[model samples]
Structure formats: structure tokens, C-alpha cells
Target: MLDWMNRYRRNRMVDHYITQLGPALRKRYGLREQYTVPQIQKTLVAIHLNTHYLAYAVALYRHEASRNTVNLRLSQTFLDSLRAEMAKRYFHGRDSYRAHDVLGLVKTSRWRGGRSADGVRSWVAGAAD
Candidate 1:
């Protein structure tokens, strides 16, 4: 994974952060000078640490199945951590990104939040991404 990450990092353009990043990233996401490589790398590393913590938690959760009392409890923390990482990396730690913060996995707000969906779909209709 490290080998692949290094290769991808070196190949991707680092200059003119937004323009070289291509239209897929889109300007409307509010990408700025603050969203540089070093900043993003640090966030990714933090996410890595959270993932390790979750993994250990899952292992402990499995072990607690036979015990009457479970020492580990993080159902909420796990979800909150996951959400925080996503916000930090993608939305640049913003509370809200654009018109509507509705997140769609398969389609971009198309089937979800109707008002935001129609709004976003019409807005990005011309872009290649």
C-alpha cells in the first residue's frame, strides 16, 4: 500500500492545487490554498490511526461475546470518528460545503434530498466529471 501511495502521490500534479487537480474535484467544493498536500497527508494519517483504533475495538467486541460485561463500548464513537474524518478530508473540516450538505453514495443528491438534488444536478450538468 505504501508503494502504491508513493507512486500515485508522485504522479499526481501538486502545483496549482485546484486546477491541476482536474474538474472532478470541482471548484464549488471550496478548495483553496489551505487544502495542500501536507495538510491532506496529515489528515489521512489521522484517519489511519482511527482505523487502527476501530480494528482493535472490533476485536475486543468479538472477545466480549462470551462475557456478561463488555469493557469496550464505542458504537457512537466509531460513527462519530468516521464522520469527523470524512469532514476533515473531503469537506476541509467545514460544517457544510455547498447548497446542501446531503451526501449521496451512488448518485450525487439525485435520489436523496430532492431540493438539493435538483439544485446540484442542474449546477454541475456541464462538467466532465
Candidate 2:
């Protein structure tokens, strides 16, 4: 029961982070419907390389712009590229690592410094409308 609760909380946290991070990335990188599959894949690769975290990469991939614009084949290709980027940045020559391991290593605290959560929430809310 306790373990389940912890897992639930973690999932929620991941969801919240994804919701906030996805749109910000889209706006920053100018990922729009006009971008081709290869172009979208490259942008995703860039995001993973910059963040060094799979959760953020996944979030960015699942963003509305990406879903509406990027096709499955290209999305899979982007995932492969993201995995390679993760291996390069975080694996440090290690042979194996899980997605959770990469996600666990990401410091959410860094987000609190430059932009307040309230500000992000408002920005995201505004964008939604």
C-alpha cells in the first residue's frame, strides 16, 4: 500500500513536470505543424541533448504540437535518437540503464531557480486559451 502510494505520487509529479515543460520547449524551439519529420526529430534530439533527461524528452515528444505534426515512424526514430543522446550524456560508457534511472537523476530543483512555478502555471494556462 505504501509503495503504491509512493508510485502514484511520483507519477503525478512526472505528469506535472511534463505538462509544464512541453509547451515551453515547443515555443522555444519553434516546433510547428510546418516542420518536417526529420526536422522535428532533430529538435527532439536537441532537447534531450540539452536536458540530459528522458522524462523531458518524452514530455516534449508527447506535446500537442508533436502529436499533431510528427508521424509514428518519425516519432520512433526520434526516440532512438533520444536514447542515443541519453547514453552519450548520462550513461558515461556504462552498458545499460533504465528510463527510470535517467528520470530519477533529473533535478527538479533547477526549475525553481529561474522561473517560479506560479509563473509557469500562468504562462501555460494562458497558452492553452
Candidate 3:
């Protein structure tokens, strides 16, 4: 069906980009064990903050694919383990109108622009509270 195909293409096209983003994410979080993008996605959903992760993932994927990077990384809780790994960085409010929902503008420090590799900035972030 066209619907199924569209959905699949819409979602699948980014899988590669997300995988390419793996190193940046692991390095930024100082992760010891390697994690696939979907595994990370599941973790975000388990914490009930997957929506933020999805939006940010799309944005970061776009950025990596030569698209745009105007989207904000929304706020939400995360696992304490990930929290401990990522909290040392600065979290800036990206949107004043939705100040409470804004988690700040984060950029990985290893990309071409000297930002990205730790892509939780525009790709992943947070606790599960």
C-alpha cells in the first residue's frame, strides 16, 4: 500500500544517517558500550520523552544530510545513568515562548562546524522523572 510505503520510506531514510551519528553520540555521552540508534530511541520512549527525541533526531539527521538545524531539543526526563553522563554540559533555553519545554541549544563538538559527535544536542538528551 502507498501509505505503508510512504511511512517506511519516511522513517527508513534516516536510519543510515542516525547510525552515522553514533560516534558523535557515544563520545558526547562518554558511553562505554556502543548503542544502536533504535535502542536509544526505545530508551527515550520508555522514559515517555520519545517525542522530543524524535523531533531532535529528525533535525540532527537533516543537519547531517545537508538539511537544516533550526529545530529545538525539547525538555524531558532521562535515565540517571545517561543523566550523569550528560549533565555537565550547558543546557540553554532555545525557545522563550515554550521556555518550560525548551531543553536548550546543544551542538556536538566534533562536527565540521566544531559542533556535533555528541549529538544529544540536536539528536538525544535527559532523565525519566
Candidate 4:
């Protein structure tokens, strides 16, 4: 019984945090939609490459943005937080690393930090594969 209770507690805590992850990412990662599976996969890869610290933050962000999170405005605070998290996860071999794991970072960086909604639409149009 005690074990069950402990597991339940852990799951609940995880769920609670998961619920908050999306809003936080959306607020930070410039919530947008992935028109293609490859783009979606890449963005997911970017988050994974990053610290992935926010306990399902990616999922939450995806849900909230309705897959169009990138189309929405992003906050500097969010981008900074993401960059810091990525720096923590980034290693010496990061250049060879796959960008999909941290799709958010790749998108932001590739755009040179100035691509508007249209730019994102173009990226998403690519095949997710």
C-alpha cells in the first residue's frame, strides 16, 4: 500500500509539472505549428538536445500552441532560458549533433533571430522525415 501511494504521488507530481511545461515553453519557445513531420521531429530533437529540463515542457508547448506555436510571438526571456538550457546540454560535439533534438533552437538560430511567421511557415512546409 505504501509503495502504491508513493508511485501515485510521483505520477501526480509529474502530471502537474507536465501541465505547466507547455505554457512555459509557449511563453519561451515562440509557440508554432509543425506543418511537416520532419520539422516536428527536428524541433523535438532540439528540445531533447537541450536540457529537456521542464518535464514534458515540449508536449505542453505543442498542445497550447495548437502546433502553431512558432507563428505566435516569442518572449526574449523564454528564448534566453532555452539558450541557457541548451548550453547546459550542448557538448563539444554539438555541431555534429542532430538539430531535431532541439528543434526550437535550430529554428530560432537559423532564422538569425529575425524571421517572422512566414519564415516559420516555410520551414514547416518541409517534410518531417
Off by over 4 Å in 2: 32-53, 56-129
| lDDT of the structure predicted as candidate 4 | 0.39
Report the lDDT tens digits of candidate 3 across residue range 18-112.
44344344444434333334544544454444243354343332212111222233222222222222223223322111111112233344546
Report the candidate with higher lDDT, 2 versus 4. 2
The candidate maximizing TM-score is 2
lDDT of 2 by residue, 23-106 (tens): 444565554423333443465565443332433345334423245334453364555554455466556744244433443444
lDDT tens digits, residues 1-129, model 1? 999986455323221122222122223235332232223334335333222233222221121122211233434455345445445644567523321231221143235544553466667765745
Top lDDT prediction, candidate number: 2
Model 2 Cα displacement at 114 (Å)? Answer: 35
Q: Can you give the TM-score per candidate against the true fold?
A: 0.23, 0.28, 0.23, 0.25
Summed backbone clashes in each candidate are 0, 0, 10, 24
Ordered list by TM-score, greatest first: 2, 4, 3, 1
Q: Is candidate 3 or candidate 4 better by TM-score?
A: 4
After aligning candidate 2 to the native by TM-score, how far in Å is the CA of 17 from where it should be?
3.1
